[model samples]
Target chain A: MTSLTQQLVDALGIMVLGMGLVFLFLGILILGVELVARCLSRANEASTPSMSEQPMPALDSRLVAAISSAVHQYRASA
Target chain B: MDGLMAFWAETGIAHFTPGQMLMMAVGGLLLYLAIVRGFEPLLLLPIGFGAVLANIPHAGFTEEGGMLYYAYHVGIETGVFPLLIFMGVGALTDFGALIANPKTLLLGAAAQFGIFATLIGAIALNLVPGFEFSMKDAAAIAIIGGADGPTAIFLASKLAPELLGAIAVAAYSYMALVPIIQPPIMRLLTTQAEREIKMEQLREVSKKEKVIFPLMVLGLTILFLPAATPLVGMFCLGNLMRESGVVDRLSKTAQNELINIVTIFLGLAVGSKLSAAQFLRQETLGILLLGAVAFGIGTATGVLMAKLMCKLSGGKVNPLIGAAGVSAVPMAARVVNKVGLEANQHNYLLMHAMGPNVAGVLGSAVAAGILLAVLG
Candidate 1:
């Protein structure tokens, strides 16, 4: 009878402590991961311009003409 | 005539006991499930074969100085195989999704609630006669909820070696049945609108972040929970090797060849424990029932957590992906995607679900460490 009582007490202790610690550990992990990501992205931004932020490079008139003409020829043949 | 009788008595057929025959039949059933039903054949096939070998009368396969005896002591008793397997799992896994959505870490933690919940349930079962489960035994049994076969086996070996066979079998079987057992619980816990909630696309994680992730995880684990370091450290080592890109050879071997060999031996060692006396008990039945319940509770908690996050995050999160927190790896994530697709065809939650799915692996290891610390 004493053994069962002790086990029940221990079970409750584990349930509380286990869930609390798991959440605590993972919670800290979430922060750590987010912090690391922020630092890395910051370093990346300092070194190179982002693709989205960069203006599109203007195409040369000659290249555009060639491309348009090729498309036109393909369309006409089809 | 006396010499002939002596030879006949030594034969397996002449010496076979009914218990041995029944255990062999169980082993055959595992093989059938592995080959014909295609259920976790990588581990199940070897395990089933080991069971058959162990049950052969007069073979002494599980006796001292035997192959199984050595495998069990060398691999399971020292808790080496599962840690090696964890390293392989780390090398194979991609944490980019988890890193992209850090909030999903809570979902992973929440899913582990099942392990603790089942711990209570196991102890409660003692109210019935003929069941004599100690706190350690209950802790070992409850880990079947973690849904990670290696982690369950490791804990069972430590806390209750006698229960290792039943625990490992239940863990793997429930994991294989995740697709079947999880859907109904997921649907019951969530609404159609919640299932179809499309998450924003995850950002592209940088190479530097990828390389640092495993190290950071190891650092945190070592600092906070040193007991978990064996499992988490090996996993981090494998991930670091892969992410560093400097040791592709080591990483490849760890993920492919090394893991494959360890898995074979681990399966056989676990199966060797399935001898008739240890396995054919009412306790085995109790362990199986608790295992299924643990999985169900884990699935429910995961879904409920996701629902809470969805509500908290203004419905940007799909509650279905929470079920992946049970850590059945790609299978749980795939089921989440399927359920999401059912709610809305255009909803592709596979990548999103991967975040919680992998987080589940880490969550279970942490849960195992807590069990070991408290109960060991």
Candidate 2:
């Protein structure tokens, strides 16, 4: 029952509202993705050194001394 | 003699109308396109077969108690099939490319202008004597521009069930023709230098980021546009299952078996709508024309946005990747890469084009949401 003029006007309204919302939504999504990536990278950076540093204590002092003595003997023999 | 004549009257050939015959031929052409030309064979083959089945006089295939009637009502009419298909697509898709380069989302957003542009075109077609599309009809027709078949079918099923056959045909046909249709527009929109621009390598996306990406997208959709929740929600669920890595069994089924099963039913259900009474109309022709215009416009706008981004980014971005924003999935992305190769053989834009290509899927879903929210 709506006239052609009315339909055209409504179509234009949808076009504007639709495009504006789509852009705004996607733009915010971009920001969200960027923030997530940055935070994950930062978290990885913060955790990595500690992870690497943890293995040091797991090695017994006796094992370290034996390895060091072996290295020293090998150098002397060579 | 009376019994013999009665039997003849009951025969299919005796009851055939020219319209039914024409529709059958159309179905046959669709079959040829699918089997011979390999145009979206998975969907077109079933759809073509369903169309043939529907048109047989007195077969009652599309009647109230018919199998196709139940198929249409249970799957497409309720809008479950497309959402299920979206979930499968989500499971199959890899978001690492989009996550690596989020700026291409703008290209995805820009390409949806084609939907809106075609909306007005559909409305304008009313000036023609035989064309009389309502606002809902126009909205449904315009979504063919999105270039995502599920979205097109979903929107058509929702907003304009009568136009479902024409819109689905136009959408899938244009999608199948993406390689041929998009390259010229992509080339026409960008200079050779712009086409040959080599993008920087995308950084590796960590597992944790991939896990959170779908959740974030779903959260935003829920907050801002709940209308899109059905489509976006399923997509996110599938992506979450895939990326969570703990649900490999479920993800594989969603990607393969579940999707394959739904595709068969969805194709047949959609084909049922192609009865002669529904499809042979002037409006159908308008839908086909507008669908192509929508696709062309979407491609052009996507490329133009890429060109703008290229200008802003100091030529580090290739504009050809913009055309992939039409969201024909890997087909559109592959077309971008092929055209990019023509300009520079060593330059592979597949990974880069994927960022916008996936974004195009999201873009069309959001656009469909907007249309549904506004009109439905």
Candidate 3:
């Protein structure tokens, strides 16, 4: 083949190889990231309390009323 | 009287040629563009001054043993300056947007079609009379479509040093003109409705993810394309330093002082190549014309890719953000955001566009590596 024609063929080869490699590399990266995220989320879920678990105990009503009355009395005085 | 005439003969007035004068005017125009027009002043100012210095008749600025000659030989010809600049670019870059949505990497890859297409166009230009670009020259010129200055310079230095000046000028000029050049192509490729599409906010990427990214990319490059190590290695180093949070000082220096110092020398070295005999050629015109064509094609293809994605994704993607695939960094992304806003005032596409913007950087680097591997 002529040198120019040979070079053109080489360039085409490069285009295919280069573009394919880039996509493959990035695809691997995407999959890796997704796996990492999934694992992290799973770990987080394991560590944190699930919604089905019992909620924290309610605050004492008398203490809450006392605090509220104190705040109300203070505001009225001001 | 004979002694006075001999001394006068030593002056610039006696040694000046029309070509040199014309080069000086070109230098002044570059200075004006940088200072008055605010076109990439960080690079254009030094390049403009260097061009002026290079054109001074009988000054020996671009000759052997001259300052610019040494700068060119030591930094540019050896291909160190562009690599250093790439390091700085990496330090300055934030891959958060790209990491949050890795699919944007496809946009970056798609945009590189411009580079390859332009390669064919440049080679085909040889069919025209008064134009003769070798395969290597065509490769160097075609890289201007990549819209990444350091990549263009690095590839030119390696493959076609003689064409470095025109190629660098074209790359940086097109990068600075991204706002103007990309918008029309973006508008033309995508319908108004497609442009108005709002993308979901990118997920917050973890610090661990950011830290691992550079290493992963480095490993991939080493395995697949060792020829790209110099450019990709340094770039990843800067990014790792930035994301590592341990070498804040090094990252700061790489992005600021180191890049600044390299930019001055690199610009001057590039400008030194703009000597009269080199710059005033039919080949230079061909380089400039092909550069625009490459950039336009890249921009259009990027938008078209986004349009395709928009279709496949059921309109979750805004085709406007695809223009950022040209790899001009935040400039191209900002243009995407602006154009998107024109279509739908409330749509903010800056962050979305950034995904493809940074992806474009990696995409172009890979393309450069491919060219070097195949042709070098």
Candidate 4:
């Protein structure tokens, strides 16, 4: 092939190879991050109980009502 | 009387040529654009002043023994200065936007079409009378499409030293004009709805991921395209210094003192190449035309690619961010945000556009490496 022909061919090859590699490198990066995020979320899940699994302790209704009444009365008086 | 006459004959006015006067005027124009117009003053100021120095009659500024000669030989010819600039750029870059949306790398890669397309355009210009560009010259000229000034200078110095002055000037001029050049193409390609499309907020990238990112990119480049190591390696070194958090001093030095020092030498050396014989040719006009085309094509393609992705992603991606793929750094991103805001008052695309903006840098570097591998 002539030198020009070779250069044209080389340019084509570069376009393909370069673009392919860029996508590949970035693809691998995306996959790696997804995996890391997945693992992190799993670790957190294992360490912490679900909201349904760990409920809050109940309070005395009469004491709660008295406190709410006192706060409301104090604001009204002020 | 004879001694006085001899001294007068030796003065700059005695030996000045029309070409030199024209070039000095051109230099003054560049200075005006830099200082008054605020067009890339950090670079164009030194370059314009150097042009004046180079063109002064009987001055040896560009000759073998001159300061610019040494600066050119030490930095630009050796491809050290541009790499140093890249290192500084890396130090300043935050890849978190890209990391949060790796798919944007494709937009970066897609923008490189401008370089290859302009290569063909450079070669095609040979058909015009008084225009002749070899493959190497075309390669050098085509890199202006990369939209990265230092990369253009580096590749031009290596491939076509004769065209270095025109190529560097064209590259930086277009870079400075990005705000003006990109918006129209971006608006023309995308509809108001596409521009107004809001993207989801990017997830935060972890510090560990940030530290690993540059090393991984460097390793991949070394493995696949060793020719790219010079540019990519220095870039990764600067990035690693920044991301590692252990080398704050080194990163700051690279980003500030080292880069500023090299920019002065690099600008002067590039300006030295702007002497009359090298720049006053049909090829210079061709280079400028081809460079504008390249930038336009890169911007258009990036927007089109984003439109395609927007369709595929069910409109999750805004097409305005595509223009950022031209790699004018935060400037292109800012344009995207501004244009997007014009369409929708509440839509802010700055952070999203940054993903493709930084990706364009890496994309261009890789494209330059590929060209070197093929033609160097």
Give the TM-score, chain B only, in order for the candidates.
0.99, 0.99, 0.99, 0.99
TM-score of chain A of each: 0.58, 0.58, 0.61, 0.57
Question: Tens digit of lDDT per residue, candidate 4, span B1-376?
Answer: 9999999999998999999999999899999999999999999999999899999988888898999999999999999999999999999999999988888887887787888888877766666778778888988888898899988998998899999999999999999999899989998998888888999999987787788789878877878788888888999999999999999999999999999999999999888888999989888999999999999999988899899999999999998888898788988899999999999999999999999999899888888887888789
RMSD of each: 5.3, 7.3, 6.3, 7.6
Give the Cα error of residue B338 in candidate 4, in Å.
Answer: 1.1
Task: Please give the lDDT score at residue B233 for candidate 2.
Answer: 97
Candidate DockQ scores, in order: 0.64, 0.66, 0.31, 0.22
lDDT of 2 by residue, B239-329 (tens): 9999999999999999999999999999999888889999998888899999999999999999999999999998889999999898999
> What is candidate 1's CA lDDT for residue B110?
93
The candidate, 3 or 4, that scores higher on DockQ is 3
Q: Rate residue B269 of model 3 by lDDT.
A: 93
Ranking by DockQ: 2, 1, 3, 4
Regions of candidate 3 where Cα sits further than 4 Å from its true position: A1-10, A47-78
Give the winner by TM-score: 2 or 3. 2
For each candidate, what is the lDDT?
Answer: 0.92, 0.94, 0.88, 0.88
All candidates: TM-score? 0.93, 0.93, 0.91, 0.89
Question: What is residue B295's positional error in candidate 4, in angstroms?
Answer: 0.3
Number of backbone-clashing residue pairs for each candidate, in the order shown:
0, 0, 0, 0
